[model samples]
Target: MAGATLLPLATAGATAQGTATLTDIAGRQVRARLPARRIVLGDGPLAYVVALLRPDDPFTPIVGWGDNFRSADLGGYLAYRQRFPTIDRIPTFRGSNVGAIDIELAISLEPDVVVLNLSSRAAAESSGLVARLARAGVPLAYVDFRTRMFENTRRSIEIMGEVLGEPVRAQSFLQFRQRQIDRVMAPLRDLGHRPSVMVERAAGLYDDCCLSYGDGNFGELVRAAGGDNLGSHWLHGTFGTLHSEQVIAADPEVILVTGADWRLYSPTGDWVNLGPGADPSEGHARLRRLMQRPAYRTLAAVRRGRVHAIWHPFYDNPYYFVALQKVAKWLHPERFATLDPDATFRELHARFLPVAYQPGYWLSLNTDS
Candidate 1:
């Protein structure tokens, strides 16, 4: 990390009154003062707060964080870097949500509040990271964008808003999120029968068969979008590996593969380059290749040209409403024939994000090459 000025959390916390007690997603009580000026975000997913609350200047209050975005979502990092060229100055800890966290180093940064994901709370506590932070007098705020998101995402957003001194903005964003969701779900309420959709998490990020979300993240998104997630029936946890044989057995009606331009991480990998300023022709080519896999050829989705690829990062962020629209569009094209997910995404960027809008976030096999 590049241009940063470290300050003591004690001084920042002293500026406010008594500590505010809030219940985290893990149902644990977190005590922290209001308007935390110095923050250390646990994983890259918490970056959603920065984009939503402080989009104009996200790096200002951020003292340190897990540098997952730079590695997992390079396009998003590049966009932030373009605007705040000095973001690299902020100190960062190694690892994402599931990785081993450096608690001692995080406390050394002296952040008044440390925001983590509820899904990773067990790992953090098992490693004694939480106790160390608590001993150092650094309050931890646990938020979640996955795992029962429909019921908890708003609470997570509101908690961040309250801690960051933007309660109004947080509530407004929740309203906006609900509206986006209603736009897709309202019409599908009276409809019966949902397409069995399979979510391929981080497609091509590995060398083996495939990984996917079971009951969380993209699995939840597919359900919300009026589709039956195959993972929900077979797997028991948030994520798990699905063998090619398992996929062939399920024969999902819609195969939705999550991908991104991870060429920097895997130059010759089969991942699709789908993000801002992405090329449709290139995405089509990559997705077509995935469809040609032996097991995929035997799947119903591929035979009917219903296979699709979408942005991978949507699995970790609060921008899932956008994913919902995209999923709905793919699961039932007839009902959503006039729906424009790209237009909705552009509206979100224009209203909330500092960056300009771009396409290629998602596409279907049937789309013109």
Candidate 2:
């Protein structure tokens, strides 16, 4: 919003033979040859959506990608690598963000199109990389799974599907996604009590008391699951920090912490390692230790053991509907007693992913509850 001015969809038109003009989530028109053979991922996690669209071989079209995936979600990375050993051979950039990308190297890959996160548009434009890529005839597309997630996820998936020549697969995944979402939202339409909730973004990854979302990402999931996101009242942007005192004052009814295997990023950090094939016993122990922090130790949520830790990557992926369903059940167990987020995730893997599904994505302090 601060840098490049995106053109409206109305201004975009058809392209010539062997090419298609697409309106990315950022409202920018990108003209790339159909079924891009060589793609560069500005953010590695985007491979999650790519996997959904190209179940047989998600990494085939990708020539290069960012390095965040290995460190951000190590378990998932390992799982995929196990199934596709060639993943390690793919060229990886140093940073996941657009600004940190080596534009010259990305262009050198001769990618048919480069997929970047919508949140990086300002940096991409400010650095003149967008214009340079245009000059090099490299189509650049924007997709969002983090900032403005709910509003842009569907369009972003559709854009990728078109780029990858898997529109039907994309539609199927979208329908599945919608069904999962409706499974949680439809019953909450006449909700009685919206639990006060706080989702600590990257909870134990940092030493800070609280880092959270506001009206977006996990915060949006909380609301969709029928909970009041306390961070929305303070932080104006999609992400920001909340003071410990403010958190104490809020006294949320439920506390949700986002976490992942951070050994690569923070070798000695106090974070919950939760992801594919993660150890629930160890994850539960970490969650218990994290709740001991002053900011949470005194909260009613902690006292009543209504605190839970969910995979941090869900805040930045299309699989968020699974998190939404899990959160819904946590917020209103009685209403969603039959809901099984784990089964839904398993089905997602069996139907669309190349890797097998593993159990340790979410853990609650009070498993019985």
Candidate 3:
């Protein structure tokens, strides 16, 4: 057989576009040559990368979601269902990791390529996933975007697209995201409305807001969404557990919570239970109740009814295009028309994403405000 085709890979680190050249979690050199058609996604972080690459495909192109309940982004996606209809039409997904991938099942499915995130790669490698997948005739590609940076995630998607023979769609999304981003961030018309913001994931422990982004992460989303995430003020590695008093003193006009633990699961109109542990909207409801309590009532978000539960990953993923629109409408109701982030998100989910039914996901707690 002819040797696999090779490209210069312009980047100093990229050995080839389709080769396993990148450092796998186990520190082994995993390289690919040109492209891979069959793919597997083992974790939620990869889901963000995939969802960003495309938004409304009828089925999850790759396979597996590591139990959607553990994912922080599902709540936001489910919340967004109300604003978009196409998302609801897509089909559900089912698959497992390489180690757990029923060899017979995967072989029956017949895929040339597969993917797993950096964090989970070590586990996959420790389990001898490489050899296992190879024996099954499936090539594995490992990637990570936990840092939550859009550029890196975009590059990751472009890499995936090239291997999957969908680079054009990936490029289209990259450009589409850039255009929307440029339009939203042109310049804040309401200079005075720049609200100091605080975002937290309500994990039951009020002090555990450490899930918050300090910098170079979802904090950037707050900026793009038209507010200042005070957490960005802290060093990237330093996340503060501010007291209720601190928040009151800061008096941020807005509070954005990662509502992933809420009861809402699917992104298709009105809230539906993602079943038992998969709910993220419940967490948001709880946070709202906390904000309205006596001690916290002094805070601005609750007082002014500016509290919002958001799918924060969009802040750093291709999904951020929808994130920006949501923030624009949330931050400046009078200055801007509702962007219908659900629509944009649905389109992205349908066009570039292989997953079906990701529309009508965003739910508002303080719509009257």
Candidate 4:
């Protein structure tokens, strides 16, 4: 909130001309053309937020975007494509990271504004893409939903709303997001116990032992859901790896592995492919296989059937509040017995998304719960 500000228009004439001075989440002041007619997304998953702001035509303003979405959330991409086939026509760069962006192609698109994630600020500046875009008379804005999720999610949504000229819609979505999160947090104090949780980041996506969240992203979500995050005690950053031995030593009460439809990224890997329309039986079998890893085979969580898998994309998107509700229920079943994450997601799709809802975002080893 500190750096996200929309300055008053210079005059009615400028307002009529469709331009406004605004500050991005990175504290950079950019003068973006109002309701950006031509917008390039630095990360493709950003479309998830944009769709919430412009449910009718999320891709109309997007002339180009990064390629991460297709590979990272193939199920989600396919869902949108099924509804809006024209999405395939949008130009996409090689990678989601700023380093992999084709700067010349982005500038050649003649975009009114280029929106990148806050994590890309350093790369954008160091690589001189920011300066180059500035010289091209294009504005570059940064929005973050990953690195510092809770601190910047609202501000990022506000910035996107201003960029899209849908301030009212953005506020409505934000209020809805808050109400959902409050469902989990407001009743947390009344709960008697906080389970020790280890969130395996992209579990089985790689052949390595483990990757995990430390103090941000899903790590923050775990704490909000009334669980003590084990990774935070060892790793200092948002993401890092934990030795299999460390995982065994921690012996967490709950083991939540973040997974997705990673077949595109890891064709033969053992990742739990959990996403829109994913097969729950297949996902459950894969999750059980992951538990067989040396790091988890003897854990109390696995033995007690407290192991679960959740969609990995929630760590980076605005829909994380839904993940929070689901996790709260998993950690404290009796206390959050009636809280329904599936219904919450269904409402989100019905209210804001252009596509219909699908129910393959999560899976659990203990089906009885």
RMSD of each: 4.8, 6.9, 9.2, 5.3
Please tell me which model should have the higher lDDT, number 1 or number 4: 4
Model 4 residue runs over 4 Å out of place are 1-17
Give me candidate 1's TM-score against the actual structure.
Answer: 0.92
Clashes of 3: 48
Which lDDT tens digits does candidate 1 get at residues 1-369? 121221112232234545688877767788886677788888865776677765655677788888787777777777778878887887777767544667777888888788888888888888888888888899988888877778788899988876776666677778888999999988898989999988888777777766888878889889889999988888899899888888888888999998876766788888887777778888888888887776587787888898888988887678888889988988887998988888888777766776777787888887931
lDDT of 4 by residue, 245-340 (tens): 999998999999988887789988889888889998888888889999999999999999999899999988999999999999999988899999
State the local distance difference test value for candidate 3. 0.52
Judge candidate 4 at residue 276 and give its lDDT.
Answer: 88
The per-residue C-alpha lDDT of model 3 at residue 185 equals 68
Tens-digit lDDT track of model 2 for 1-369: 111222122111232227879998878778888778889998999989877776666787789999998979988898888878899999998866678788889899999999998888898899888999999999999999989778889998899878887777788889999999989978898998899998898878888879999998888889889999999999899899999889888999999998898889998877888898788787887888888888888989998989998999998899999999999999999999999998999888877776778788988987722
Each prediction's whole-model lDDT (CA): 0.79, 0.85, 0.52, 0.87
Clashing pairs in 1: 2-88, 2-89, 3-89
Q: List TM-score per model, in order.
A: 0.92, 0.94, 0.64, 0.94
lDDT (C-alpha) at residue 119 in model 4: 81
The collision pairs in model 2 are none
Q: What is the lDDT of residue 217 in candidate 3?
A: 55
> Which residue segments of model 2 deviate by more than 4 Å?
1-17
Considering TM-score, where higher is better, how would the candidates rank from best to worst? 4, 2, 1, 3
